[model samples]
Target chain A: MQVRFWGTRGSLPVAPKAGTIADKVADALVAANGRSFADKAAALAFVEDDLDFATGRSYGGATSCVEVDMGEGPFIVCDLGSGVRELGLDTLRRCAQEGRPKEWHIFLSHLHWDHIMGFPFFVPAFMDGAKIIIHAGHPDAEQALRRQQEEISFPVPFDWLKADIEFRTLETGREYEIGEVTVSVILQHHSHDSYGYRFRDRDGKVAIYSTDSEHKIDQMHDENDFAQFFGHADLVVCDTMYSLADSVSMKEDWGHSSNIVAVDLCHEAKARRLALFHHEPTYSDADIQRMHEETIRYEELTRDTDALEVLCAYDGLCVEL
Target chain B: MASTLEWQVDKRDGGTVVAASGRVDESTATEFAEVLGEHAETAGARLVVDLGGIEYMSSRGLRALTLAHRRGEEAGTKIALARPNETMREILSISRYDMVFPVADTIEEALAS
Candidate 1:
């Protein structure tokens, strides 16, 4: 199975300002230092190998959306944040290019505006024979989504969409089979209550997607209990929307976890690889990189012989297990 | 000693002081919220929570505090914290609850403020 991240930003989507982009260009030019490139290949290699992670690569500004590829199975996606607009377009384009029928399954964490705001713009929904399954923990997920396209807010009504839309209310902790993958969801602590999903393919490869969930070390499940729930998953996508100090203090009860909590939890759970996700909108790529470094240091200091792998989730990051 | 958090209200200078002790976590937050609500029911409950005895407090405890603070504000009953212990003080600073509440040096100063 391959996991693809379409959006990793939290709270809302944001793009680098003109000044920020210009600064990056200037910084890159300064790094070049008036030295002429030997060739296009050499220049590309310089940017790829020599450029700083923060200045060269962007974490991107799209809100939460991820796609999990299970070979020969239907398209599986998580969240409908603004990033889904791109996912929807991309999926439609691929389907048209490959002449594949569109059968999409979307898992929504909650019905918050940022999470559901992309549905109206999902182009496939306007096309006939498009199958869309929305799986969520919220009982009112259908109503909430329908309300978004009510005539007052959007030009198109929910019923007017040509796709065959289905809503599934997932039972907590129940293992479900969607196409070729098995999934289990757990309720997470958030204002509107989000659901975290654990997916496993027939090959037994596990991937966990959990965001917008606040985790407190003292309040979280016991290490053993969490280990059982996580059960040696290959990847656990998590919320690290704040720094340790902020998560513990000013943002406490704001329904977001810190990198510290994510690291500690993943370490205890013994998950193979943990992806720090749902990045705070206010945090620059540099801030996230620093946080990533600090979290790595913290993990190293606290860890025993075995070290848990950690990676910051960025838009377009893909992992195969 | 009780295993759970304890809340005791004492009538102090010009206000009510709710002293919290033990672990204020998920298990005790609901009870804590109820206790704060009882004081908030009164028309003018100038309430100052004393966290000096709190052994441990997590986000659940913080949630209860913020809810009480907002509710108190809506009802015209001021809620503040006086004489928080070192741990609680650190938590308050981190959660920035200090900014939301008037942190006084003593109960007298809290009530006076």
Candidate 2:
């Protein structure tokens, strides 16, 4: 199996080139601490100007989407956020290139706008005879899709789509076979109804994906839900939408986990690797890199028992499982 | 003393109905756990928690349920839930608690099994 992250930012889309501003700010901060008062003041002003420019670019986009390819099996795509539009187009290109039919299995974590916003823009769904299977937890799964199709929210109704779409309501912990891969769904705590998924191939390799889960301080001491959900998986793709400081001070109960929490869960579950996903939109590439480094240091200090590898996810990043 | 959250335990044909009311928050989770623990030893039969009247549940509430489930396993009793509301169902689903315990759509279905 191969896993790819098409979109990693959470809540909204992030600017593609905001790293330049972050670099400049880092340089300014470094210079300010090393220089005289006059130089420090000038550096601070430059930093403020760069931040203003960066914020404008970071705030204007959509949410998370990721794609997974199980070798010769079903095309499993997780979350249909704005990233799915690009993924859908990429899928069409891949199918056309490979001379195969367009078939996809989409697993939804929940019906939150940030998670499902890209459903309308998925190009293959507009093509005739394309087959799409949507697996979600809501009892009124079809109605949720139809609600998005309402004339008030979308210009084109869901009826305008030409693809053959089927909605399957999934029960937690029930394992189903899609081609050679066995997929299992687990429930996750979030603002709304959400699910975590585990996929295992015939080779016994497993991957668990979970996002939008809150890791409270108390959860650290208790037997966490993620620990059970991700037990012994080879790879875990998890929510790391906030830094530990940010998560503790501000984003508490916002239904997102910190990178440290993700690492801890990975450690507890004895997962082989951890891919941190659902980055805060405000995090520039440099900020994410810093967070990743800090998470590694924290993991190294706290992870006395497990040999877990951690990776930060970016748009277009891929991992072979 | 069995920690005191309000509960009515009714013996049925082949199972015991444990009807609990009020919010099962962190403060009252111990009481909930004690009730199930006590019932596990005395009932000596299948157990069904009727959660139709439960208005709210936190993670602690889930812990109590997990304790009951584990206790039932140790005691060799079948444990299930009857008539959980949409919110409760969602909580159970996300936490994967539904998988550990049988969830019935109705009391009759729960009792019959």
| Per-residue accuracy of model 1 over B33-106 as CA lDDT, tens digit each | 76776776552658888877876565456656666766787878888778877766655654455666788878
DockQ of each: 0.05, 0.02
Lowest-lDDT window of 10 residues in candidate 2 chain B?
B90-99
Query: Deviation in angstroms for A247 in model 2?
Result: 3.1
Quote each prediction's TM-score.
0.74, 0.64
In the range A97-119, model 2's lDDT, one tens digit per residue, is: 87645888988888888888889
lDDT of candidates 1 onward, in order: 0.79, 0.74
Chain B TM-score for the candidates in order: 0.86, 0.88
What local lDDT does model 2 show for residue A232? Answer: 90
User: Model 2 in CAPRI terms: which quality?
Assistant: incorrect
Query: Per-residue error at B45 for model 2, in Å?
Result: 52
TM-score of 1: 0.74
